[model samples]
Target: MHRSLFNILSGRNTRQGLWGLPLLVALLISLWLTVETTQFATAENLFNLVAQAMPLIIAAIGQLVVVLIGGLDLSVGSVISFTTAVLALDQPAIVLIPAVFLLAALIGLINGLAITRFNVHPIIATLSTQYIVLGITRILRPVSGGTVPEIVIAAVSGSFLGIPYPVFWGIVVIVAAWKLLYGSRYGLHLFAIGGGIASGAESAARNFGVSDRRNIILAYMVCSCFAAVAGVFLAGRIVSGDPNVGLLFELDTVTAVALGGTQLSGGIGSLHGTVIGALVMALLANGMNLANVSPFVQTAIKGGILLAVVGLQSRKKMGL
Candidate 1:
């Protein structure tokens, strides 16, 4: 039994299984909701669900990259908050949009440098940055009242060929992330670094000529840039730049990544898994809302789900 379990959790079987599990879970949840309530299966509800999941889908994909490199960015929520605040200013898109991206990238660079150059722990580095960015975000917009450009809202929320723009954007992120992570040399280095960090094989990876620093920097940059994108979409959705909008987004992204079967210790994961994971989260929340579950209970249930998923991975690692 132990050997069989190991076999199931190892090799391509494990990868394929993990990649598909979230989809299966999401489907089951959708089916349950369809049977339990009339509010979940309509085309309008489906579009709304996809719209709600877009920012998270993008954020989770970005977080997956950092996780692949064996690190965490607790500042993603803060970055989103900051971006929304910046974008809320009555500035032109040509200026504010690029500015937000650059600011986010700068934050990522600093995070990478803190971890690589200064040897700061990833958690500490990101946590500190989170606080800094959040403070600035609050200062920028002490509250949630600011205008989001109407054009931005129309562009993000508009549909083409019967598909919402957010859903299309989510699909694009998934495909691009899949190719970049699973089909490129840089991706190889990232996986190597991640695996090395987890297994204490950094020397071996370096000897294999992996530029850990460059890959780590790039990973963080990608993560921040994606978070910024999510922020933009969120700003458009709410039509304002609320400082508190993305308060718990980091938790959601991390949980989604974990639920998707990405090892928290790093190395093994897929964008497909993350996409399905995000979908599962959206469905779960939708189901809960439809059931009239309390908001507090929903948070607790989500936390429990995260813990259970992470525990399962730990158990698998232990071959238990």
Candidate 2:
């Protein structure tokens, strides 16, 4: 029993990475919050917390898809902002919803092609796309005005059987992501490609007939689509469009991924870990708000967490 517990906590010989540590951190934070704040344990607050974290949870999952194959998508925030802007346009829901995802796919395709075909670094490619998308998003909405479709609003708000719709949204997204990451042949290919890249053998997966380039490209497209989904959820919540709504979301998603024990070098992660990491972040934010911490300080604290988490990674795991 002792040995099993130790192995579980240490994540010994596991490709899932050090998720156990984050799980413990999340529990500790929750306990502390519950003890420190009367509001923290309340039903309303707990539900609200889930709702507040849903967007990050969704975007982080998308980031995880790319990270699994040793890639990144800095443009996700911009994609999200662009999505909200498009959804808020004076257009019908059928047209606007499909258009949002279509544009996101195009953005992802461009990022993927630049990196795979043109040999552009993932960061540089996505960052460039980030600026371009943000520019277009600003052009679309200049400011946080205009209305999202009523259906979009309805999907995110309200409850069923005393549970908020956001809860259902999260469940559906999580279930779908779980299926894609763990229940598909493509998922296996992703880990294979990422493993090769992390091990300094970029062609390793290709040698095995994995078609690394195509899979990597698909990963980016999946990332952008997920970001668009988050954007739609956010637009519904805010009931409008805001160019800056997704500002720093890239940072948050990356941090959450790293915090969850997903190696920056890629090919080693778990969905549950990512979700737990996101929950930890949400808990911290909730606690900080309850403590009246300044938003600037919260941002700084988050940055510090990201730095510390990444810094703690071994040079071998980072492929440095």
Candidate 3:
């Protein structure tokens, strides 16, 4: 009975109406925390917050594409970590940077293909790939250290005025992605593909009447590209390609996306929501750390928040 009720309610537009919740909740949390803490509102503090969050934003952007195709790319975190390790190879700036982005895209492509061809769920396929990629990276590097060119560091860490470059990049990517992911025709299909693939597939697919056959490929492609960019951006900021980079990033990115009201079941989303969600995630994390919460406890809080929000959406849709 419970499962039937959930299935019935799950078929609604809960994603569209919840865009502002993340921002509002984040604001309240930040304000409450800031009122009690001195570091929450400082320009320096803001700069650091944005800087630390750049990777999450970047990874989430990539993950957004994966989500759009009604697929999850769990391997992305491992991919990011792998790319970071590659960047730590101490290669020339020109060579290392390009390689990172390309590799990321390749991994995404492989993920898409693996899912499509192997008749496997994206979660399972990517999970398997995640292990493989992590193993390879660990066997090859086993540690993290590399020097990003000074210019690269300045571009990501430092800012033009008082603003950090990280914030600027986030804004730029958010705008561009908003325009590309939500403001265009193809973007519309991505959303529709998740709602009702059988009814909508004929319109969305060109080859075999599947909703977004090409789009599925492209979605994974975009996800991987962003993952690569995130890896490089972090490497530039950190000035090293640490082996441990992006550990558990998939959980954070997925949580942010889900928190932004993108349905885990797929076929709905907004980049704007994702942007707000990323900010919320950063604030939640920062606030927790500043409060000196235990890492395990913080993880519990994060997971709980996701579960609670998803539960609310589920119940609301059921007319509860």
Candidate 4:
């Protein structure tokens, strides 16, 4: 029994990575917050916490998809911002909502094409797209003043059976992601592709009849669509468009992904791990806010946590 527990905790011989460690960390953080503040465990605050973390959770799931194939999407934040900008445009919900996702898909397609077909590095290609999209978003909403569709607003603003809509939103997103990543053939192909790349055999999966190019492109498209979903959630909560709303989100999502025990080199991760990792981040942010810590300090702390987490991984596994 003891050995079995250790294997579970250690993630021995498992592709799920070191998720148990983050689960422990999340529990510890929750315990600390519960003990440290009178308001931390209050129902209102708990609901607020779930609402605040929903966007990151959704976006990180998308990030996880890309990371599984040993790729990164720096454009996630920009895509998110762009989505809100589009949603807030002077248009009908029918037109704006579909347009937002369509644009996001296009952005992802471009990013994928640049990397896969043009032989561009993932970082460079996504970074360039990030700038382009951010520029366009800024042009659309210079200072966060446009109104989002009423339906979008309504979707996030109420409660159902004593539970906030954001909680339901999270459940839906998590279930969908679980289906895509664990229950689908595409998800299996993703792991297979990523594993081969991580092992320095990029063509290994291809030898098994997988179309790496198409799958990788679809992964990027999926990532952008997920980011769009996050943006929609944020738009409803904020009730308006804010070009800067998604600022630094890419950093946070990547940090959350890494914290969740997803390998930077790819092919090793779990959805539960990512959720746990995001909860840890959200918990820390909530705790620090309650303690009256400066936002700057919190940002620095996040950067430090990211660095430490990445630093702990073996350079070989990181493909460095």
How many steric overlaps are in each model, in order? 0, 0, 2, 0
* Model 1 bad stretches (over 4 Å): 1-17, 315-320
lDDT of 1: 0.85
lDDT of 2: 0.92
Q: List ranges where model 4 is wrong by over 4 Å.
A: 315-320
Candidate 2's residue-wise lDDT over 261-282, tens digit each? 8888888888888999899899
Candidate 1 per-residue lDDT, tens place, 1-320, comes to 77665554442455322655676688889999999899899999988999889899999999989988779999999999999999999988889989999999999999999998999988899999999999999999999978877777887879999888987787777778878987899888888887777676656578888889988988999999999999999999988998998888888998899888788777777777888888899998888888889989988888898889878674223211
Instruction: In model 3, state the lDDT of residue 115.
Output: 68
lDDT of each: 0.85, 0.92, 0.74, 0.91
Worst 10 residues of 3 by lDDT: 311-320
Q: Which pairs clash in model 3? A: 144-242, 194-267
The full ranking of all candidates by lDDT, starting with the best, is 2, 4, 1, 3
Candidate no. 1 TM-score: 0.93
lDDT minimum window of 10 residues, candidate 4: 311-320
Model 4 lDDT tens row, 194-294: 98888888999999999999999999999999999999999999988889998989889999998998887888889999998899899999999999999
TM-score for each candidate, following the candidate numbering? 0.93, 0.98, 0.88, 0.98
